[model samples]
Target: MEFRFTVLASGSTGNATVVQSGDKTVLVDAGHSLKKLEELMGSQGIAGHDIDAVLITHEHSDHIKGLNALARKYELPVYANEATWAALERHATHVPPERRVVMGTGEEVRFGSMAVRSYPISHDAAEPVGYTFTEDGYKLSLATDLGYVSDLVRRSIIDSDVLVLESNHDPEMLRMGRYPWNIKRRILSDVGHLSNEAAGEALCELMTDRTRRVYLAHLSLNHNMMDLARLTVNGVLEDRGHFFRKDEHPLRDTHPYEPTPWDQIKRKAL
Candidate 1:
């Protein structure tokens, strides 16, 4: 069976993505309210009961806001590193002890038919991390909420078949926008979100012909336009002689992100 994945929602307001390989279905984050999450999943023909686990990226409310509620309702397991667990335990009191699973950076967690590994990311949080899910020979990397791409990150996602990466904002738009100076500085800081230019540069280095899909995620609603982010990344790829097909829809247009078949990607692999 083909592995399945979808970015149910992605933004500052909330973030969540579903990944399924065979019987196991997992959610990457639950930043929205339980109700909103249900609505988003429902749109993709997934019910709340379908998820077997929740993998948290960090302790930020925008990523864990719905965690407690979702866990309580589904009796699902939640995975995170020690520091992130500590922070979540402090803030999300409703998650049951049995449901909290501790996973270290680079450690693989296996459930159902999928194997997921977490990698550390530079961000202002207790212990932020991105995840890579592998099934059979195919890999999908979800690396958002990162400040900048590190060597380890680049190495981890180098040959991924699908990449859901952050294109958080456009620097020019951000610098000229009305956000306060402190907020702007925080965003531009090394420990903050990745700008579109940075994301484009990183993708140019990471992407190979094997990459079948690329989703630009966690975009800043106020500082980044979807078309602009698409254009920027496309330009970078084209400049490097790696061109994405024009028929592909941007992540924003692929509402409930679905997995492209591994066979198709394999045929295009370099």
Candidate 2:
């Protein structure tokens, strides 16, 4: 039983992830157009229709843009919580009747060859939640768009082979940057995005023996650099007695949600 994941895109621009077990594949988000997504999957030697389902994290444009269109093109099922569905229903069109499965926080939803659990998050929305996927004995946890990682969210991320966690910005950079005071304040709020330091600190607290790979994600293209995100996570990891050289960290797919092998680490997923 082999488990893999991939990222279609990361950062504030767009976000998507593909997780698969053997022949079954699931897309965590579709932030790109169907054409772009199909091209990306092709680059990885996967067909667009190979995706079994689409799981949305929130209604943010960056995460939801390609969802409706992708579903239209591929006729794929979409699994999202009730509130998330309500917010997105205005955009739903072309999705088949059996394709919408409304879920809730802390509930489990099963697809072929894998079991998934959704848990509430602190993002400013109606019951936004992160996802945890398990197949065989390996676990992959996906959490982004979180303002602050709560105890419940923290506990759900434990014992994983791969973690696609968010490190949205650097406090110093965001604070000193030219963004307006209101936007900055909103970002710093509990229901806002996560800062590099905050994300690192949260991971430090939630990590365990089973947590091996960590992929920093949902970065702010405006205020943060890849090196900055990597450095922050590495710094926190080292402080918590879990250090890895920059060259030694696990990488994600070219897009978000792309999987790296559980045992190998790289700058980007292959």
Candidate 3:
């Protein structure tokens, strides 16, 4: 089977991703406006009606800003944990009850040829999770908007063919930035976003020969630059003996305003 992944947008401003297996296509989050989501999907030849479901990572506005609109417009099934659904019901009231599907963490759900499993992550929200999708022998894991990599998270994403991990900010830049102290403290806390150095360290333990592509995601526009994130992550990987190469464990970049080109991973038939 062939599995495809695309980061529609990844930053503190918004977050969304597309995961496709066989004929089924799932939108991981609808963080942008309905119009913006449509445009982003259109760029990849996907229509609103083409989506099979929407998966919520948490109830944060940056992750669910367009959930109600997109779900209602497409009549799409929106899967989320119980706590997240409760928070969504209070905020995203436009979504019909029939469209709300409760998915438990660590349970494998099938959407056509794709099997998706959610794992808990430490974030200051009702419930935040990172997802891993598998088809045949190929696996693609997405772990973003997380503060730290727990043992569950590490195990969930192990042996992934593609990984989308967070490298949110640089410690020095975030410390010196003009944000208020409380806001900075929250970001620096374990319940906050992951720093670039932390992401690199986690990757050292996570990346393996099976891990082909890793996209640095959920970057802070003010606290991080694309080049800087790549350089920092690569540097840490190199120092830890994980050399960067285009054909092996290459680091990829994601955009906050656009969609990444579809990355396809194929597995041989049994």
Candidate 4:
């Protein structure tokens, strides 16, 4: 069976996606309320009952905000690395034992016909990770909430068919943004967030002729303009003789993901 993926939602407001392959379906994260997910799925002619699992990247409220409620309602399994699991355990009380699976960093996990791998990222969180999902010959990678992309992260997502990458800010924008000094410092730290220039730099390492699409993700509503992020990444990628396969919505099936899947990504593979 052929696999398909769609960004149900993104941005700092909320995040989630729907991935399906025949009888198998997965929700990478569910920051949006169950009602929202239901609405998103319905818009795409999907049903919430079709989802089989939910994989979380970190314990941040933006990523886990609606997780417990969804888990309780659907009895869906949720996967995360040890440290992330521990961090979430403090708050994910509604999750039943059967629905909480502690994933091993850098190891491939099976969700029916799909294979998901979590790799460590540069984030301050306990064990944040970027995700790569493969089925048949297609691969989808999600990289967000990271400070930067290192050699390890580059390798984890390099050959992906579709990559949802974080373009969190523009250096100049962040420097001039209204965020307080301390918050600005945190976003610029090694474990903070990826700037547009940084995101562009990272893409240089991961782009390939095989890369069918690239989704710029986790855009800072306050610090970035879509045109700026798009142009920055495209220019950098162009320098590498690469460009986003933009014949479609950037990440929608007919296009795939959206303005950032709001999850915290840190490298575990490296």
Candidate 5:
């Protein structure tokens, strides 16, 4: 079995990713418009019809903006926890009955050739969670849109072969930026998005020799820069003598607005 994941698009504007195992493909998040989601998937040689499932992390607009349309367009199953499903109904009103699948955190769901398990995350949304995918012994963890990493999250992703984790902002930048005080406080709170330092600290506890790649995700457009996020994560890893390949280090996707594909890392042996 072969497992592959791609960051089709990642940022505050919209978020979406593709995870594939052989002929089975699952889309995580549909934050962009239907057209935009199609373009992004097409750029990676995938079509809307090929998506078997859509797993949502939360009900935030940046994560589920196009979920209703995408699920309706492709007749795909959309899975989320009860609260998230309830929240999604408010935003993605057009999603039909059959397509809205309710899944609970920590429940293992399987597709054609892979298994996915969602774990609780520290986001303010309605029971937000991250996911872990395992296929033929290889693991890929996706944990973005989270404020801080919890012990449960650390346990879920510790031995992952590839980690797409959040490094949302720089604390200093956020504090001094123009976003309102309440928004800033929420961001800095435990249930808010992870700052670069917080993300790196989480990585320190999660990375191991078996971990092959790390992709820093969900960066704030106005508060954080790609270089700064990368530098912060790299610095943390290096300080602990856990260096990584240039590609394996946390890096940002270049085209935040377009359907983009990052270099796909092949599944590594366990």
Candidate 6:
């Protein structure tokens, strides 16, 4: 079976991704508006009905903005932990009870050929989590919107074939940016987002021989430029002697507005 992953949109503005294993398709977070979600998915030839489920990472607006409309329109099942569901219910009342699937952290849920599990993440939102999708022994993990990489987070994503990790900002740039002090402190907190340096260091520890692709996601438009993020990460990897050739371990970039090209995960030959 073919295992594929795509980032539909990723940034502070919004965040969403698509994970597909053969016939099973899952949408991870629907932060865009209903119209924008449609356009983003349509760009990748994925219609609403094509998605078998929606797995939420947290209750943050940037992660669940369009969830109500999308779930209601497609009659799709939405999964999240109890706290997140409780927090989300206050605003996304349009989502019916029958469509809500409250899952426990670290619990595995199957969607046909795909098996997905959520791992706890330290974000400012209620019960925020990251997801890992495993199919036919191949794994695709996504860990973004996290302030720092905890031991649990590191273990959860360790041997992934493809990883979509956050490279959110440059610390110095953020410290000097125009945002209010409180907002900056929130972002720099333990429950905030990860910086480029942190992401790079985390990658050095997380990357295994099985790891092939890494997508730098959720970049800040004001504080981070794509080239700067790439350069910083690569520099870190090189400095630590963990860097590999582009073909061996390609670092891909994701856009906040468009979908990344589908990345097929192929298992290594015995």
TM-score of each: 0.92, 0.88, 0.96, 0.87, 0.93, 0.97
Alpha-carbon runs more than 4 Å astray in model 1? 248-270
Worst 10 residues of 2 by lDDT: 259-268
Judged by TM-score, which candidate is best?
A: 6
TM-score of 4: 0.87
lDDT of 2 by residue, 1-270 (tens): 667777667866677777877778888878876777777777777787888888888777777878777887788889888888877766553356578887777889877778988888888776688999887767888888888988788889875777888888888889999999998988888999988888778877776656666777888877787787877776876888876566755533222434333332112333
lDDT of the structure predicted as candidate 6: 0.91
Give one digit per residue, the lDDT tens place, for model 6 in 199-255.
999999998778888999999999998999999999888888885766765699999
Q: Which candidate do you rate higher for TM-score, 3 or 5?
A: 3
CA-lDDT, candidates in order = 0.82, 0.76, 0.89, 0.76, 0.84, 0.91
RMSD value for candidate 5: 2.0
Off by over 4 Å in 6: 268-270
Clash pairs detected, candidate 1 = none
lDDT of 3 by residue, 37-67 (tens): 9999999999999999999999888888888
The CA lDDT at 14 in model 1 is: 84
Which runs of model 3 end up more than 4 angstroms from their true locations?
Answer: 246-249, 267-270
Ranking by lDDT: 6, 3, 5, 1, 2, 4
TM value for model 1: 0.92
Q: After superposition, how far is residue 39 of candidate 4 from its true place, in Å?
A: 1.8
Model 1 CA lDDT for position 24: 80
Candidate 3's TM-score: 0.96
What's the lDDT of the predicted structure labeled candidate 1? 0.82
